[model samples]
Target: MPGLLQNKVAIVTGGGSGIGRATCHRFLQEGARVVVADRNPAGAEETRELMEGNDDNSAVSVVDVSRSNQVQQMVNDTVSRFGRLDILVNGAAILIRTPPLAEVEDVDWDLTMDTNLKGLFYCCKYAIPAMLANGSGSIVNIASMSGVRGVAYGVPYAVSKAGVIHLSKVASAQYASQGIRVNCIAPGGVDTPQMRGSTASAGTFEERNLEHPMGRVGQPEEIANLITWLSSDQASYVSGSTYVIDGGAWAIAT
Candidate 1:
């Protein structure tokens, strides 16, 4: 039998590493033509290289999602290369550690919002038209537990994620009638480079692992599993919902 996304074409931003890299691999495993897009050329190429015998099924596009022109070109290029755009995984983001909300510098705030929130908006803006022409599409936006609840450390990061969640909702409302599905996933403590780096130290990272109700943080593959499901026709009826994948950590916190 063919894979779930056998005939689909997808563009996954931030496909250079972490959850984005995992999602790109998962999408390809499910038999989709994937464009591994990221600002880091080396990372994107590395991801594509890791795919066994999938050279023709995958390509890499270097993009800074924060820039509208680059984002537009990325969409145009994908459609040009693949013939149509069927799926979009907006996984490009950055998390900067800040002192506190009051002490958060303007530069940090702008950078975080630009890449995390504005970048997502730009992806949706450009990809929507392509999806509309295809008659249907699935979009999965990556958010974080920081957005859903209060957190002490990165205020800009948390706020940007919250924007992503709400933006997904608004986009779903506007486009679902057009046969496009938009959804968001807010993961708590996933074991990704971003998470580890944001933790700032090995001790904090271990603390995160031990604090999770499951005795470990979620893995990138685990998050990618849900992303693949949401991107496929199996979730044709699902849209505008934020699914939190946090390994039961949120439950314990509540």
Candidate 2:
């Protein structure tokens, strides 16, 4: 069978590592040309290396999605290289653990929103026109369960993700008549290098898993699988919805 994304062209932001990196590889596995965009050049290169097979099918753009101009240029570059944009995975983000809403530093809150929420806005803003020109598109923004049920010590991160969830809804409404689908995915306790770095221990990791009814953290590829499906024609009828893949975290939280 032909892959789900056969002949598609996709841009995955934060494609240097974690969910972004995994999504890029998954897109490639589904037969799509990929542009791996990230603020981290080294991490982007690592993803490119990991996805190497057909050199002509992949490219890398080092960009901070928080910058509108840079985000615009990255979208322009993708079209220049691939001719049309078909799919987008906005997966770039920063996770900041604040002391409390009362004590959270202004700098930390601003940085989190700028990177996590504003960045997705910029990507969608620029990528939309390109997709419109192509007459169809699919966008999957990686949100977090924090957006839905909130997180302790994660006010900034949680709020930004909530914004992302709404952004997807608004964009979906704006573009659905024009043949585009927009959706968000909320993942919880994913086991990535970033996650491991954030928690810092196997014991702490187990405790975090205990918070989920599943008793295990998610894997990056597990999230990637859902992203690819949403971006594929297989999900032609899905849009403007938030899919939670958080090991039943929301159920237990509520």
Candidate 3:
């Protein structure tokens, strides 16, 4: 049988490691030609090697989505090489625990918002046009559980994601009639390099794992599967929705 996304073209930003990288791999498995767009050159190439192998099934675009020009260029390059854009996964984000919100500097605030929120905006801004050319498309923004709940865990990261949730909602509503689906995923604790690094020590990760009712954190591939489904025709009727894959933490909290 052919893959779900056979003949589709996709761009996964922040596609170096963690959820981004896993999503790239998943997209390729579903027969979608992927562009692993990342700010880190080494990480991007690593994912490219993992997915591209010896074929042109996948490519890499070293991009800092925080920059509009770079984001524009990434989109242009994707179209130039792939001929069309079908799926866009905005998975680029940064997490910073501050010395309390009072001491959070303007630079840190800007960095978090730029990468997490504005970066998604730039991708959506450009990718929508390409998707429109195809007459339909799907855009998935990787948000966080903090965005859904009024929590104080990493103020900048949480706030930025909250913006992303609303961003997806607004954009989805605006373009639903145009055959584009805009959705957001608010993931809880996933076992990604970023999640491991977010804590002070390895022990924290283990403890955090047990905190979830599932008794363990999530895997990047788990989230990746959901994202790829959303991008495919399987989810053609889904739009303006926020899917939470937190392994039951959010379930107990509410």
Candidate 4:
């Protein structure tokens, strides 16, 4: 049998590494043509190389999702090359560990929101029309557990993720009738470079694992499983929902 996303065309932002990179691979395994997009040219190219076959079915786009023009162009180019757009995974984000909210610098706050929140907006803004033209589309925006709960580390990052959750809801309401589905996922302590950097040390990263109910953090591929499922026809009835992929960490959190 063909894969779930066979023949579908997708754009995965932040496809350079972490959850985004894993998602790109998963989408391809499911037989979707993927555009690996990221601001880091080297990282995006590397992801494309690592993908199986890496033939005409896959391409890379160096994009800063924060820029509307670049995002628009990325969508236009994808449509021009692939003839249509069917799925989008907005996985670009930044996490800057900061002092408590009051001690947070103005620049840090601005940068977080611009990339985390506004960047998602631009991707959705441009990708939606492309999907609409095809009569259906699925979008999975990667938010964080930090958004749904309190995190002492980065206030701006948390706030921006919360915005992502709400934006998914608003966009779903606006477009569900038009065959576009929008959803958000808030992942708990996943084992990614961003997580390790935020933990600030290997010891701290391990401690985070012990703190989790599963005694281990989620792997990038683990997160990608849920993402691809949501992007598939299996999730046709699902929209405007925030699926939390935390491994019982939130359940036991005090």
**What C-alpha lDDT do the candidate models reach, one value each?**
0.94, 0.92, 0.91, 0.95
Give the residue spans of candidate 1 off by over 4 A. Answer: none
Q: Which runs in model 4 stand beyond 4 Å of their true positions?
A: none
List ranges where model 2 is wrong by over 4 Å: none
lDDT tens digits, residues 1-254, model 1? Answer: 88889989999999999999999898898999999999999999999999876778999999999999999999999999889999999999998999978888999999999999999999999999999998899999999999999998889999999999999999999999999999999998888888888888999999999988888999999999999999999999999999999888888888
Clashing pairs in 1: none
Cα lDDT tens digits, model 4, 48-109, are: 99999779999999999999999999999999999999999999999998899889999999
- The Cα error of candidate 3 at residue 151, in Å, is 2.9
- RMSD per model, one decimal: 0.7, 1.1, 1.0, 0.8
Instruction: Encode model 2's per-residue lDDT on 118-232: one tens digit a residue.
Output: 9999999999999999899999999988898857867999999999999999999999999999999989889887688778788888898888887888989999999999999
TM-score of each: 0.99, 0.97, 0.97, 0.99
Off by over 4 Å in 3: 52-54
The total of clashing pairs for model 1 equals 0
